[model samples]
Target: MLGSMAIRALSLSPLDSIAVVVHPDDPLDWLPALGNSAFSASPSAWPSIQVVTCTEASQGMSFSIRCGLKALIDDNPKLDAVVVVLADQPFITTGMIAELIGYLSERPELDYVATATDVGGEGEQNAILMPPAILSRSMFEVLLQLEGDAGARKLFGLPQFRGAALLAADRTTVFDVDTPADMVLATKQILGQTYIREHRF
Candidate 1:
């Protein structure tokens, strides 16, 4: 998942860092130990990661969000913005992340830039804001207030985030990977597109 997420900052700058917030007992055992850990020590590959254990993760998504943001803040006091992309959304592309960053950078008046897919039944559709969002430093404190099971998108509708913007993303690019069946379908989607691209040459 991390391999697919190395996106350059806006202006083609180096993608500085990434901090993965894992539960203390999460199965991804290879994560390194080098943050303000809430758990004991244990020690990865490209981009060089530092795992931040969210002991209060069970409390809600807010805790995890706060934990991850705190780690980033501690590391880079001058952080411009942050892109909160979920690991399950492996199909998220670098171009998508860059757009979020670039758009937010261009509009300092905005609190965040978010991606949304058209979701609806039958032939109707509506833009439903989702993650893989880029939020300016101004929005970090608001994110800390998110509650149980609430995602970062929760704050998008609030009065404080009035100037937030949304970018439409293709549905397939945000295909969620929550189940084995979903993984199978995502693999087929990737491979099918690869096959088509290769033969088109």
Candidate 2:
């Protein structure tokens, strides 16, 4: 399962608890299978994960984020922060997840740390901050206040928020499956076809 690959990446991260948020229409039963598969090849000390069904997922991405954060908080009140990664990003790896967590860890003052895209220019205005992101618990309340399609990145612009941006090392690492063409490429990568990856730029 493609999502299993994504979950495997998360399972390998240095997290205490993991929560897989499923939408209303998704097969909630897949959670167990995915979790088992994810941890199969993971380290023996891999974190245990629970599946959460976001009933209001149809409302917006904000709902999914809220549901996921709440689940994680409930599972472990002492949880200091979380790294949010989209399941559609099949190419996401354990190192990428670790890097984001490490970046935020190195700077304890950070409210959030996210993948940054440099739109070929200078300065902060030319940069765009997106997930997968590490959000400190201090910023959780603000995320709960988000509505509509606004994601965690929306909170980056809030007044006095201290967020860091890790410039993405490769476009493939950020490649998200949003279209049929994307799925085809993801399939090619999954099958170990090297040409597509070598020429992805």
Best model per TM-score: 2
lDDT by residue (tens digit), candidate 1, 22-61: 7888876333322223122222212335578999888877
Give candidate 1 misplaced runs (Cα > 4 Å): 1-14, 27-48, 120-125, 193-201
TM-score of 1: 0.75
Q: What TM-score should be assigned to candidate 2?
A: 0.85
Q: How much lDDT does candidate 2 score?
A: 0.81
TM-score of each: 0.75, 0.85
| Residue 30 Cα positional deviation in candidate 1, in Å, after optimal superposition | 7.0
Taking every candidate in turn, the Cα RMSD to the unseen true structure, in Å, is 7.3, 3.8
* Ten contiguous residues with the weakest lDDT in model 1: 5-14
